[model samples]
Target: MIEDPQGTILALFAAFCRVGGCFLVLPGFSSARIAMQVRLFLAVAISMAVLPIMWDTIYPKVSGPTSTYIGIIAIETVIGGVIGLITRYYVLGLQFAGTVLTMMIGFTGPPSQDILEDAAENQLTNLISLTGLTVLFMMDFHHVVMRALVDSYTAMPMGGTFSPQGALISLTDALSQTFTIMLSLASPFILYGLLFNVAVGLVNKLAPQLPIYFISLPFLITGGMFLLYFGISSLLEIFANGFVPVFEGR
Candidate 1:
């Protein structure tokens, strides 16, 4: 048997598709803070690390025509991308919660650059999202996501039939679950904001001369801050603890 360089290259590239595809959109790994070249190198390194374990499954598929090779790469990239998307959905959910928290606390500030992406965001949401993602990293979210990738191979075989319907269903399911989890995490703040706003509205009705919105702003913000100070710990703790399970359960 001849050792073929082309065959070897194809197999490696196919492996890279999955690993790199995931990291391309994976929370911390995909952060704009990290240089693109660095991310590329890191993805290559991780793909190499796992290539040995995945070689038997991947190499067999890439030993084909040039057109077939292109198809294989596309398929692998899509597979990896979907897995990454599901993982990312959870992180994004935290951002949604942060938006809710900001509205509830009435903590409006000038928009700032987001640490994760190239976008303008309020400071409170920015802080919550950054903190939540940081906590997820500390909790080894990469390991879990990677593990899920490995497991995904079993659920979806290498170079087998691709099911758009299945992928769509999975993505929809993830979105639904992520929203539910985020809402649950932000519920307390929602209730607080509702009651506080109602009271402010009542006061405004009683004294039309008073600048109720302005007068209540400090109290609203202060109460919110106090609630967050005491409850933030538990809120984040619960979110971090349940994230993996809730995501994996789906």
Candidate 2:
């Protein structure tokens, strides 16, 4: 093959560092379940797949004196990190919503070691995090993540540096949107828990000697599960819907 070895190696390494660094800390990929070595390989594989397609255009823009090229590479890495962080923070919204739901369901406890991810999470918190990730994969939302990485190069470009103020503003807007979505996603469970607890409290007041609160444990657990089952689909749909705009920052 007629190939420029130096150029190819340079392009490969640059792309690897940029993409790998982003994925190393990005949410789903960064989960405790994925081994660091596998994540590294996946990042390299992604960069390899993308470089051949993008390098023809990207290289020209980045071609310049050594100092200029280095600066461009740094800025591009930062832009990649920004995009990665947006998706990651969106996932955090699910975790935040889970935390709120756990509090409402009376599962408050000292942080315990989680089995699935081997992180410290209350039982309900772990369930929600795992479920959210499962739903993301099932809905092909990760494909959107790859697309966002590609689109970022177009929006931000290879050699150009975005204004720090503008990027900060975008980050702030993304966080706000994530918070709003989290509240909305958990609203059904939130309302249900509130009413259920209030009713239980009233009942307990009326029958102080009857151990009504103890009697309601089974009902509360059943009600919570049913409510979650009914609302889970909608929650996933809402998450899928919100995925794109945050990535595009539109």
Among these predictions, the greatest lDDT belongs to 1
- Residue pairs clashing, model 1: none
TM-score of 1: 0.95
The lDDT of each candidate is 0.85, 0.77
**Residue 184 in model 2: lDDT:** 94
Q: Write the per-residue lDDT of candidate 1 for residues 121-175, one digit (tens) a residue.
A: 9888888888988898899988998887777777887778778898888888888
What TM-score would you give candidate 2 relative to the actual structure? Answer: 0.85
| Candidate 1: 10-residue stretch with minimal lDDT | 1-10
Model 2: per-residue lDDT, tens digit, 30-142? 77777879988899899988788788656675456889878867776777677677778888888889888776665676887764456688877777777777777787776
Task: Give Cα distance to truth, residue 53, candidate 2, Å.
Answer: 1.6
